[model samples]
Target: MRPTVLLFDIDGTLVTTGGAGRRSMEAAFEKLHGRRDACDSFPMSGMTDRAIVRKAMHIIGVEDSAAAIDAVIDAYVAHLAEEVHKVDDQRYLVFPGMREAVKEARSRSGFAVGLGTGNVREGARVKLERVSIYDQFDFGGFGCDNEDRTELIRCGAKAGAAKLGVPVEECRVVVIGDTPKDVHAAQGVGAECIGVGTGTFSVQALLDAGATVAFPDFSHPQALEILLGGR
Candidate 1:
């Protein structure tokens, strides 16, 4: 059956942010929390924004409450804005065959596209727009909404289902991402996950994480077809 919802991960899946996201997070901590030592070495690949922030706070012995989280996010936004201004060349690039994959998925009957990513709402928009693919996603779940990756996938699925006026349970959700976290999130919701080894993780790692299918990269048309086919 054709998937009713195609949930995509932003960084490392649709577009590559290089080290911009990590730099932004570090800048936020330094500027807002008055701690340059915070997040000196935190694993960012495939982790949610909230998870990253919470871990960074723990490392600095700071408590992460709702208010503190908001402040950090605000700081992150500010830092991202400032950094984006300084960079004359665009660093974010759309993954090869990503646009064609999105288009093909959308062309399929009963298919809809949305994002489930670790990026905050504004950050997600900024990155997607930087790559000129912001309009492809109809809706999304942001990192600010929740700390859990599974919850984010659920939120994205719900939003897509709502947009199509279908029941969430009836939606055939297919999650496309480049991390084990994404595979786990899709498994949490009993949805199909397609793992692309374009990120830090390898294809074997994704398979071990329980992805329905894994690819070295989506640059191949056959891989893209299999992924969009919900295999």
Candidate 2:
């Protein structure tokens, strides 16, 4: 088997933050700009924290710049740290079999596991640590890396490959995520996506979005095969 690096998305794939992320974002925006509902109108699923801040800023007639967006994200992470404690493994659902699947991938000779998530790195850490899955991932491509989903995925894959001592171009990268944007992101870099319908979209919707395979949840019987690109 060729060396494959797998990157999992955080929010809806590995574990649901159960609104802690949203509440944190809302709180941050309110504190920073005095706009209590700054993030209310944006389409958030699969979007990066920087993307969210940019969009929200645009909606509120604020200038969108690297420095300004960065400030918001910095604030967002701080607020997230506070709000994340509200979510625990008992309250947040870890998709069935995900932990074991990641373990299985780690044990395989030609595989490496990491994260490619839209959450900012710190926010992702907070959310995953609460769910007890943070230790499983050592490197990640995060919203802090890039606001663009496609670029972030590539960034993540490269990082994962580097950590495994493999060349990025030679690595067969598979992104496991739960949104159409995740599938589209993989397409942007010519990688395959294993889409799980643990988010807003259904399985068929994920397939329609160009995922190599789509499963209703991580519990699906052929999940391992699908994750490994065997199907």
TM-score of each: 0.93, 0.96
Count clashing pairs, candidate 2: 0
**Which candidate ranks first by TM-score, i.e. highest?**
2
Error of 1 at 65 (Å): 1.4
Candidate 1 residue 34 Cα shift, in angstroms, is 2.7
Clashing pairs in 2: none
Per-residue alpha-carbon lDDT of model 1 for 1-231, expressed as tens digits?
733888999888887776677778888898888886687776687788878888889889888997897888888877776565454446656777788888887777778889989888888877777667889888987786778999988899999888778898987888999998999999999889988888888999999999988887787657776765633
- Candidate 1 has an lDDT of 0.82
- Residue range 39-157, candidate 2, lDDT tens digits: 89876889998888888998898889888888888888888887777766576878888998998888887787899999988888888888788999878889888889999999999
Candidate 2 ranges beyond 4 A from true positions: none
